[model samples]
Each structure stands twice: as structure tokens, then as C-alpha cells.
Target: MEAAPPAPPRPWPAALAIGALAQTLFSWRVTIPHQLVFDEVHYVPAARALRALTAPANSEHPLIGKLLIAVGIQLFGDHPLGWRALSTVAGTAVVMGVFAILWLGTRQLRPAVVGALLTILNFTVFVQARIAMLDGFMAAFVVLGVAAMLWSMRAHGAAMWRRWIGAAVLLGLAVACKWTAAPYVAAAAGAFLVLRHRRADRWPGMNPAFAIGVLAGVSIATYFVTFAPAFFYAAEPLTWAQLVPFQLDMYRLQTQILPPHTYQSSWSTWPLDLRPIWYLYEPADGAQRGILMIGNPVVLWGGLIAVCACAIGWVRTRDTASGASAMLWLFSIAIWAAIPKSLGFFYYFYLSSIWLPIALAIAFDRFGRRLRYGDEAFVLLSAVLFVHFYPILAATALPGPQAFTRWTWFDSWR
Candidate 1:
């Protein structure tokens, strides 16, 4: 028997170009309907206030997401395009990040391409990218951080340390964007440490304890640095003495639900796609338009099944890649499920959405190795679902209210 030849590396330039083009085509619409939709109303105003150096706005969330939005506002002026510019960039980064992570983990071109396409076409990523919200930026950072961690698992010496530090900073910024990203960061760190332990021979000089300490120190420092402007520019700026209490206060505020929200959905229904947040729905500019924040059913449902299969495969074969993908997905879902809130939204599923494509990619990679055109069929079905739901996802004006009902397959979706 002959040793099998190594597979050629993926074409980086072509993959990135495809990812960027997909992101630009899907999310870079500057003047579609021309109004703030959903949480854009909250975050955009916070960004504007940040630009004006006004009192801290949207105090419940951390400052980095607004800061990014503010950068867009400062550079582009406060318009639809201006507020959403950074989100567009972040969404694009997410596509590239997904590609990198899948490629690094599976070491195959087809899985990487399929996973990135699935992520790019996912309604959650696409719709969120078109708006100014913390979730898209948070999701992007999480994906990038995880990708860096995945890369670090294969590197050694200086390159490995740099990748670890990069992962920490990115994950820290993710937490600064939204606390919901914390679990994914934690899981990535755990994965990193485990990989380092398993491959200890490859990293003879690496000290796991010192490396984890560095990751923690850098992550916390980066998170606090993101709040520097908030501390510096607030009307009643907090001194070093008050900064700790301010964070504590923010934590307290997060737990205190002051009002009920009609659009809130329980975590239990997320995987089933039972409830979707109606980000926008009204008559605008002589036409009826709406933005429904819902995951594409084909991807979401298929991804869920794929995740389960990955879990089973990991248990059966002890495959590190499958195990990592399964753990990341399950942990992301568990974080949301464990949130003791009666008002969680479907968009809270954003973290799991980041890992779902990876899980699907893993499943497809295994199946494609055995069956011809398996990955292609899966990708095609996902694209078809995305196209079918594009009208509602993009707030496209319908011919009539009756036409709107055509997209609403389930009563709960309406």
C-alpha cells in the first residue's frame, strides 16, 4: 500500500474574493427603503451620541459596538449607509473567518467553500449585516477569534503565541461588543488549552499555565480598553475608583428587566424556528416593506441535524475536529438556554449560528468523502431557501399584503 498524498492547499485569493463579493452583494445596499429597522434605532442613536461625546447611551450594552458604529458615522455621515457601514464590514469579515476556520480545521477546499457560503447566505448573518446592531459585530469577532484559535492549534513557537494573543484580543473585543459572546470566547480558550495539551510534544517549551494567564490578562485588558472612551467622554466621567462599580452597575442593569417586549422568544424555540422577530413591518415610500429577522429554514434545520450527527460521530470516532465543532455548537446553544431571561430573542441564537455552518461543513465533508455531490446538493438546497426567503429578509416591497402571506409559511412566522 502507498502513502496517500497530501491535499493541495485551498486557493486563498479566490476563496477570499468569492467571500468578499458575496458579502458586498448581500449586505452593501445603502438606500434600500432608507430607514432604521429594529435595534438599529437603539444602537444608531447610541453611535450618534458617542460621536457627539454625549452622556453614555445604551448603557445596558458595552461600548465597543457603538464605538465601531460611531467610526462609520464619523467617516460617512449619519445616514443608513453610514450607520451600517461597519456592520457590512464585520459581516464580510465573518464570511472570510468562517472560510478560514473551516479550511484550517478540515484542511479541505470543498468543506471550507461550502461552510463559508452557508454562513454568507444564512438569513441571520445577511439580515444582521444590513443593519447596525451589536450581534453582527459580536458574531464576527467570535468567528475571527475562533478561527485564530484554530490556526494556533497547528502553529509552533512565536507564530503560535501571536495567534493565541490575537485570539484573546479578538474574543475580548467580542465580549466588549456583547456579553453574549463570552461563552464562545471561553470555549475557544478551553479548546486552545486542550489542543496544546494533546500536542504537547509539538510545543515542548510552551507553558500552558503561563499561556492561559497571558490570554486571560490580555483579554480583560482589551475589554477594559474598549471602554476607555466611555470613561473619558461621559458627562460625569468615571474615575478609576468608579470604573469597577460602573461595570457592576451595568451587570446589575442587564439582569433587571424593566419592561415586557412583545417580540421576545424563548431559547427553546430557536432551533425549531418557531418565533422570529419582526424587525420592520409597515407601509414605507409608497410600498409595503418589512425586515423579518429569521434564520433560513433549510440551513437552520439542516444545521441542527448536522450538529447532532457531528456529536454522534465525535463520540464514536473520537475525532478532534468533529468534537471541537460539536462542543462549540452545543456550548453556544447552552449559553443562551442558560440565560435566566423570559425575554430572550431569536437573534440571541446568533452565537450558535456562527458554529452551525462549521458543524454542517463537518458533516458534509464526511458524507462527501463517501457519496458523490453530497456537499453540492446541501449547498444548493441552502441557497434555494435563502432565495425563497430573500424578499422578507431584505424588506422587499410586496405587490400586496396577500403576497406577504406567501412567505409566511407558518402562522408563528407571521
Candidate 2:
């Protein structure tokens, strides 16, 4: 019987474990040059104000994201490193959450593992994770909520109501993290409703109305949990009419952020990485102080190509999983690209970084069909690529020649 073929290997647990481990390793790089480089100036001050109930009502972003930074300050002494610690953890959580999503989406380990590796090696993910920003946290919550919704779809038990409720609550949490999470919530909810309607025969006694009620409850509860501070304290002593306008004012402020900065690129050029932001750069007495920017030329360029390929493949194949993943990927990209009023930067797309891995996975899946390279080879190539680019991604002090060598791929990336 050929020794039963070793049971064909379980990929989910292994993928989850590998993703977790990679995230942990990546978290260490976060501590190098332990200081704020980019948006820390705005957020750190806001976090401090949050602690004192003096945060500006005119502030652009919502309170929940800043509150998350405050939690890191509450524990870690309110330094740059302390505030960024929250971002680091959130970034790692995104990796774990993405792994869970891949596992649930495909119900196979090979794709899950490939997805995890792609995520770990992706330059955008590396940059966002190691910085002090809300994007990482937003990404984490969005991915987690999507994973929960996917799991709820497949779960069948006496406690199925609990799973559905949990998924809804997670979606609400994602919303509280960032308004961009709306797309994920909409996608997941629509999918769930369709699945419930189609599978009524399999799920006997399942009432869509009752399920919707559960979702509503979860959404309310989660929102209250995240914003309890804002509601209970009433930091601003304004009338009810004034409060709504104040919130609108904040939104308006964010829309008109015309900051004069070098890396302030338009939305059209973002997908091409035409204007990469310089997160950090300091001079060295010797020739050691090279650029400490994120975005590996290979992965960034590869992901762009892979995205086009995935789009075409999705169109040709019409695989539901491929279509759904591709649609969500493109939707997130389109949303970021279409934001007309905000002073957009490269990091804004960090929340949708999950698409990077999906693109790469699709690329690898395509490779798997024609090439002799097996799954193990895919893993090995991913590891090699990650390691080769690890130093620059981590901002390690490399000699000028060494840094220049890595820049050989694209002058625009400089």
C-alpha cells in the first residue's frame, strides 16, 4: 500500500506556526535604531494628549487608533520606542491573522504556507510593522475580522451562533481601528448572507433574520468596547449638536492635509512605488550610514506583476476562491488609490498589505503547475529572498558599496 503516503501532511497548523515565528523574528528588527522616523511626531503627541483628555478634537484620525498607541505608552513609559512597541505587536498579529485567513480560505497548508512566507518577506509589511503608526494595528484587526468571518462560514456546531456573533464583533472592532475596514466588513457580510441563503438546506432552522440580529448585537458591543472612553468621559464639553459638527470638522481636516514633504506622492503613482518614502537616514563618520527605507525592489516589482497576473488568472479561471481573493485585493487597492483629498503616502496601503501575499501565492501557484520545483522549493526560494534582503529591510548599517549594490535594480527606488 506504499506506506499510506505519509498522510499527505497537514499545512494549516504548520503555516500558522511558521507565520507566528516569522512575525516574532521580524519584531526584533523593530527595536533597531529605536526611535521614531516617520509619523511618530503627530501620533506620539496625540497619544500624550489622550492620556490627559486634552487630545485635539480637530485631530484628523479617529480616537481608537490613538487610544491603541496610548495603551503602549501606559505600559512602556511613553517614549518613541514605547509607542512603537504597540505598532510592532500589531504588525506581528497581522501576520498571524493573515496565516489564519489563508488556511481558512484554501483549506490546505501549501497555499497557507506560501501566503505566510510571502507576507513575511513583503517589503511593505516589514516597513509598517517596524514603525510607529496605526496602519499596522488597522491591518491586524481587519485581517483578524476577515479570518473570523471565513471561519464562521465553515463552522458547524451547536454553538454556531457564538461563532457568528464573534465574527460580527470582530468586524466591528476592525471598523473601530480604521474606517477603511468598511470594505472588508461589507465584503464579509455580503458573502455570509449569500452563503446562508444558498445553504439553507444544509443549515436547517437557520434564520437569516436571527443571524442578522446577532451580528447587530456584536457590532454594537464591539463599538462600545473600543470607544467606551470617548462616550463615558465626554472629554469635550460640547452640546449634542456641537458634537456631530466637531466630528465632521475632524474628517474635513484629514481631507485637506496638504503637507509639504518630499515623499508626498499622488495616489496615481503609489502602485508603481514611484515615490518611496525615506523613513530614516542618518550620516555616519565613515561610509556606514546608508538609507534605512523599506521596500525591496524585487518584492515590490514582483508583487506588482503578480497582481496583474492574479487579476488575469482570476478572470480566466473564475475560481470562486481566486475570484473572491482577487476581488478583495483589487478592491482594497482601488480604495487606497481613489482617496482623492487626503495627503496620501506609501504607508496608507499598509492595512491592505494582505494582498501582497495573495499576489505572490498566485504567482507561486502558477509556477507549481509547470516547473519541477515543489512546494519545498517555493519555501526555500522565499526564505532566500527574505534573507538576502533582510539587512536593508531591518535598516542594518551597511557599507556604501553594499547599499549601492542593492539599489542596482531600480534607480527610482533610491
Candidate 3:
């Protein structure tokens, strides 16, 4: 019999412990001021409604996220801190989860570390984790679902069945978190189908039957869990309206507009980093006072190059992990911008931020081959810039001129 492929080596606990340190350092600057920065206004009310079991207006997103927020409120009291507690937790989870994904994908510890560290340094992930909004939770579910799917692919026999079921459940939970997750699910399933077709007749029928069952069960449970109270009422029972209001609320939120906001940016500029939304600004109170939110210029700029690298890698070698990751990253960023919605903003690209780290990891993988001085210099330069600007990007207060200079690309940001 052919020798079984050696199992992927697990990183030492010390490396994982370092990842925890990174998570704490990056996330600690979060939760300061304890005020709702942006979308918290909408989600906070929905969380409160969830606590009271009342159907609130504009609660169109999935309930699991709101329910998570409610749990935070239960722990922290129904204030800004309470509403925001879950966001921090979810953000941290995404950090760890993404690390696990990168580790699993390439089966390389170094790449996984790079991915996690880059994710922590990114402006979008940092700010979103600190705020009370659905994006952080949505990101957590997306990455988690993707990780489960990856694990499912590597499993076999009875183990394979279990992994498939897990993947479906996670994907279903992802959809139940945000309708935006639909594209990711489709991408994953599509990727799976393509891979299965390529490997047909090599093994037992690679039907995703167990996965489908788990997906259906989890989707229904996740949906109804939010409206169990509504179902309790004898007169109303379960109605399509209950399940859909959350979606409609999200739909309306995307398309509807109120008074023009100060920092709204067109979607077109997100990829170019031409416009970025400012989440918070306060006078410097010594070291702790400075805080502004934006995507990491390193990840933002280098990520574009990484995209090109990822495309080239896929074209040359047809590596699904590299190609799919790059495709998802670009899709996550551009697809939303392409939507004909009126109220789009730079922050809508927050979840898209996850891919920057993946892109960088791919770039690093390429670097290992040639190791040219220029490539090494480029990597070092990007790392320095990421570290240098991280404080400001994560809302670290500096003198006024210092802060404004970072706002180099100003058109869409204003």
C-alpha cells in the first residue's frame, strides 16, 4: 500500500501562546471610551430588543449575533460596554480562527503566524472588534465556517462524515449570522464540488449528503432560535415574516439612507484605499488618548501586490488554497462596492480585511523560493510600516499633525 501521507505537524504550544499574546496586545487598545462608534447604534437597539424579546425595527440581520450581544449585555449590563462585549470576544475569536486556518491550509507554522499577526495589525479587524456591530461576529462565523470546511476536506471515512457534518453546520450558522455569508457558502460548496469532480472514482462516492443534512438542520435551528418567543404565541405561530424581517432590515439598511453622515465613502475607492471612515477621534490624553481607525497601509498596499502574486501563483500551479483565498479576498472587497446601494461606506469592507493576511502569507511563500534582496527588503519595509503605523491605525492618539498625515488618501474618506 502507498505510504500514508504524514500528518501535518502541529505548532508548538509556545507559538500558539504567542498568538494569544498578539491577540491581547492588539485587542487591548479596543473597548476604550466604551461608546458606540458607528453601526453600534443600530445593533445595540436590536440586542436590547433581543433581551426584551421585542421585535424591533431594523433588526434584519441574523439573531445569533444579536443573541451573542445580549449575552454580553447580561454579563456587563445593558450599556455601551455590555452591548460591545461580544464584539470584542468575536474579534478575538476571528484572530485565533484565522491563525488556525492559515496553519491548516499550508500546513506551515510560519505562515500561520504571519497570517494571524497581520490580521491583528490590520486597521479594520482592530476597530471592528472594539465596536458594537455585526461585522465582527459575521467575520468570526465566516472564518470559522471556512476552517471547518478545510478540515472536512482532509478527513476520510467515518471521520470524513463527521467533518462534513461540522462544515455544513458551521456554514449554516454563518448564513444565520448574516445574509452576506451566502456568497462564501456558495464559494466553499463550489470549490468542494470542483475538487470532488477532479477526484471522482478515486474513492467512495464523494457525496456531501451528511453535510447537506447538517446544514439544513443548523440553518433551521439558528433561524428559529431568534424567534422562539414569536412561535410561542398561539395566534401567530411560525411565519415567514419572522425569519425574513431580519433579512429585510438588513436589506433596508443597505439601501436606505438617513441624514448624510460626515465620513461616508463611495464603495469604488475601498480597494485603492482612497477613502476610509474615521471611527473615533479624541484629544490626546497622554499615551492613551490617541485613537483613529483605518486599514493597515502595509496590508492595504502590500495586499494589492499580494493579490497579484496570489493570481500568478494560482495560474502557474493551480493551488486551490491560494487561488480561492485570493478570489474570496477580492470578491469580498469589490463585490460589495459593486452593489447599487445608496448608503455604502468604507467600513462595509471590514470583513474583506481578513484576506490581507492571507495575501501576505502567499507572498511570503513565494519569497521562500527566490529570497532576492529586493524581496527581502520589501517584506522588511512592509513589516516596519505595519508596526510603525499600527498604533494610530488602532486608534492610538498622537499629535494632530501626526494623525492627519496618516489620512494621506482623503477624497472618499471625507
By lDDT, who's the top model here?
Answer: 1
Error of 3 at 165 (Å): 2.5
Off by over 4 Å in 2: 1-16, 194-217, 231-243, 257-260, 283-294, 297-300, 304-317, 362-367, 374-382, 400-408
Candidate 1 residue spans exceeding 4 A from truth: 1-4, 201-204
- Per-residue CA lDDT of candidate 1, range 1-414, in tens? 998998777569758786768667666454576888888889999988888877888988999999999999888888877888888888888888989998888788878888888887778888888889998899888889988877776788899889889999999999999888777666765776787666665435768788778778888899988878876665976578877888888887788865677777788899888989888888766888878888878888889888888889988987877888888888877887687564788888876886788899998886447767877888888889888888778878778666768778898888
Highest-scoring model, TM-score: 1
Of 2 and 3, the candidate ahead on lDDT is 3
What are the lDDT scores of the predictions, listed in order? 0.82, 0.66, 0.68
Cα lDDT of model 2 by residue, 306-397, tens digit: 67766677688755566566667678877876665656776665655567676666666654467656545655765687677666666677
In candidate 1, which residue pairs clash?
none
Clashes of each: 0, 1, 6
Clash pairs for candidate 3:
60-246, 290-396, 290-397, 291-395, 291-397, 292-395
TM-score, predicted candidate 2 vs. hidden true structure: 0.83
Score every model by TM-score. 0.95, 0.83, 0.83
Worst 10 residues of 2 by lDDT: 283-292
lDDT of 1: 0.82
lDDT of 3: 0.68
